[model samples]
Target: MNYRHAYHAGNPADVIKHAVLAFVIEHLLKKEAPIRIVDTHAGIGRYDLTSDAAERTGEWVEGIGRLWGKPLPAALEALVGPYLDVVARLNPDGRLRFYPGSPDIARLMTRPGDGITACELHPEDGASLAALYARDRRIKVIDRDGWLVPKAFLPPKERRGLVLIDPPFEERGDYDRLVEALGAGHRRWATGIFLLWYPVKDPVAVKRFHAMIAGLGLAKCLTVEAIWRPVDGERLAGAGLVIVNAPFTLAAACRAAERPLWEALGVANGRLGVTGDAA
Candidate 1:
């Protein structure tokens, strides 16, 4: 209940997550049909990088900070452009001050007819999120437990959309919960895209997670991982996303963008991979 993302906003994990998210959303936008976005565990939509919490951690220094204004290879430019465009709009002055969370990213990528439902469990964060989008008719903010999101809102009216499940693993057994939630959601919305995010702290736990998902019999599943450092101790060494029903072109785009992303993030030994049939 006390997990706050302000300290880690715009960090390496955010970079990878948002980059993939941007690519996915851009792909979805290709179709003329209106799409919906459901962000479970959505934090405050926008964050000020100069805030006290951000200053204390300064995590962005190793994340978006390194990528700002940096040139990218031709292959990666298209894949990562949408995300960087959003960040650029937020910091038009060319100084990185504000950082957008998943909800904000969705808002930026979505078209007029598309909609978003963001669920934030933290009371204060939820309030801030609601306030941030109060005047935006396309967005709906909900203050509730993210775990119940599939039950309350699945099989969206659009019938074509994305579900981003990014839970803060502050509680024990969160990994198990994530798998269960995804399975349940998949059952209800078989064709919908599902992106489940997790930290790569314990390799064993991550392996178990992948095995569990693999056993689910999902025909189209891809695991994208960005490992910046060795997995050790309690600190986060990397981030991962299990993408079910991924777009056909997403895997190739991710592969091409991996090296450039790693270099931009200043990680010499960073690793990126796409596993499962979708790859």
Candidate 2:
């Protein structure tokens, strides 16, 4: 795969994905017990919006850009504060320039007892991720296939934490691979939280995928999404997340954070739904 996340960094998909990510990590941090964070398919830990790649897309202009300093409603702010806080920290001068990937978001939230494993299969991205946290003892960067990480790194010794699988979907089998990864990981760590991301193109295919996951028999799960346009056909309509063993409060939180996204991005017909134990 020749995908470099930099080109799409801070786009609408990322806003929802990372917002939910930071939200979940913050929830995991509430416990004093050591928690492990594994970011499979972790991209370069951080991004510079001024880079040539980011400039080519300018997707951030409609993403984090719209929300940077905008005043938000209380509930929405509470839901997305954790993520925006990281963005704010990266832009102390009150200018949007830096964006943190899943690894960086989790790395900053980690306490001494908490540890993070960031795995990136892309060669250059993996090396960049490794060097980004070279001095950070709490994070261990691995260059390996994320699809296998769940099996190889499941049941984290910490016994409690999050597993983030955000593949680029550059391969035809990625959805199948995600299903297998979740199944493999759950078998080893039934209680560990698992968060996965997928694009909202092809509504029918998306629903079929959701049903397939429900059949996997996870105890508790929910699907949260934001659809800016009609979900009638295949296109980059929006973004969605499938979270297994999610917090009881996550669905409501996801709902709260999603609308503001459409509002901020000036998009229409923001459709959000698909929350349930397995559906």
Q: Tens digit of lDDT per residue, candidate 1, span 1-279?
A: 878999899999998899889888998999999999999999999989999999999998899899888777788886678899999989999999999899999998899999999999898999999999999999999998889988999989999999999999886588898999999999999989999999999889988988988888899999999888888857788989999988888788888888888877778988988887662
TM-scores of the models, in the given order? 0.97, 0.96
Let me know the TM-score candidate 2 reaches against the reference structure: 0.96
Which stretches in model 2 have alpha-carbon errors above 4 Å? Answer: 232-234
**lDDT of candidate 2 over 195-275, digit per residue (tens):** 988877777777778887888988788888778777667568877888998777777776776666567778877876757
The residue ranges of model 1 lying beyond 4 angstroms of the native Cα positions read: none
For each candidate in the order shown, give its overall lDDT on alpha carbons: 0.90, 0.84
Itemize residue pairs with steric clashes in candidate 2: none
Lowest summed lDDT across 10 adjacent residues in model 2 is found at 270-279
